[model samples]
Structures are given as C-alpha cells and as structure tokens.
Target: MIPARSGNIISTGSVCSYIGGGETHAYTCSKHAIVGLTKYAAVELGQFRIRVNCLSPYLLATPLANNFARLDHDGLENLANLNSNLKHVTLKAEDVANAALYLESDEGRHVSGHNLLIDGGFSIVYPSTCFSTQNKIENE
Candidate 1:
C-alpha cells in the first residue's frame, strides 16, 4: 500500500501496543513499536502527499478454529466464551474486508497515520488473547 502511495506521506501502527501481559517484561512494549515506526514514517513522509495508516482487525474467525476445537474441548469452549461480549457478535473476515475497502476508498484519502481498529469490541474486553498471546498448534 505504501508503494502504491509512493508520492504520499504514510503512517502505520501495530494498534495493540498498549496491551500488556502478565509477568512479561515487555510484551506490550514489543507491540508498541508499531506506534513509534508509524509516527516516524508519518513525520518523515509528510513532505510527500502520500499518507500512511493501519487497518487493525481483531479476533476474526480463522481456519485455526478447527485446531482449537481439537485442543481440550474445554479449551475450545473457553475460547468461544472469551470471544463473546454482552451482545457476543464475533467479527467476520468480510468485516475486515469492508474496512479495507473503506480505507482504500476516497473516504480514507485524508486519513493518515491513524490506527483503525476494526475490532468487534473485543480488544477492549479481551486484549490479551485477542491480540494473540496464544497461538494454536498445528495438530489434527
């Protein structure tokens, strides 16, 4: 995307840099690096018309669902429960695609160096697992 906006100033963000972990010295810090890089690029590229921004999506269902299903059934159940809220509507891949469409459309032309969170209200509630402190193993 940056290359496409070659003449424009650009920004990018990891978006979840603010999330921290338990007994981990720098879990949050590592994620936060995206913010710094984003700001740096924004400042450096402002001279150009190119703009930078990030589209951050959270907890979208993926193929890994089956693997999680294979884990202890309780683990899978726990994850399903974790992904819900009072209203409990998990996000779809289409949701994120729509976001990218909006970002790429004329509507987002002026938007730069912004972290667009497409989270289905999940990040605010389950930041730790939502951003993936745990990765599902590839076992069948």
Candidate 2:
C-alpha cells in the first residue's frame, strides 16, 4: 500500500476495546491493542495516503459468540437486546460489513485512526445498571 500511495487498513475490534465486558483478559487486551495499532499506524502511514481504522462492534449472535456466552442464537440475541441502549435493534454481521465498506470507500477518505463503534450505543450507556433501576422503580 505504501507503493500504491493510497490504502485503507481496517481492523476488527470489540466494545471491550473501550470498556470491560466480562470478556477474557486476553481478549480485552487484544482488542485494546488493535485500537492502539490503528492509531499508531494511521499516524505513521498517513503520509503515504494510507488510512488505518478500526471497527468495534457489540456482541452478536455468531457461533463463536454463542459458544462463549453459552447461549443459543435466540438466547444470545435476547440478552444483547435486553442490555442494549438501542432497543429493538439486533446487530448483524452485515452491519459490520457495511461499516467496513464505508471506511474503505472514498466517502471515508478523510476518516483515519477512527474507532467506528457499531455497538448500538452500548459502550456509551450503562444499560445494566440503568435498566435494573428502572425495573425496580416500575415494580415499586
């Protein structure tokens, strides 16, 4: 890509990259590393017109996620939706792909070293605590 003078390097990350999600220490560390790499590489490679970015998505009901969460597809989806700040919207692989497409396309030419979060605002909002408190209030 250095020779080409234009390139886009996109890496996969997780919400764990920005916040703890009860994931394994190694997994969280690796995700964090990906963000660091994206930032550093973007700085170093920008002169060559190479863009480096990351896509951090929340939990999806993939086989690996299902196995890790020990839940079936529907169960995992339910759990994710229940905890998501954006209710009624289930994340899909295609959503991540679309983000990748955007980053790679000319539309994102000016975007570099960006960690595009596809987490449905899950990383920004503490749904677990907020929802629990809401439930308590409703019950009361």
Which pairs of residues have clashing backbones in candidate 2?
none
Cα TM-score per model: 0.60, 0.88
List, residue by residue over 48-72, the lDDT tens digit for candidate 1.
6566666655433455753634555
Against the unseen true structure, what C-alpha lDDT does each candidate score? 0.54, 0.86
Which runs of model 2 end up more than 4 angstroms from their true locations? 127-140
lDDT of 2 by residue, 33-76 (tens): 99999999999999999999999988888999898667899998
TM-score of 1: 0.60
**What are the clashing pairs of model 1?**
7-50, 8-49, 8-50, 9-49, 9-50, 9-51, 10-51, 10-52, 11-52
**lDDT winner:** 2
**After superposition, candidate 1 runs with Cα above 4 Å error:** 1-15, 22-30, 64-88, 126-140
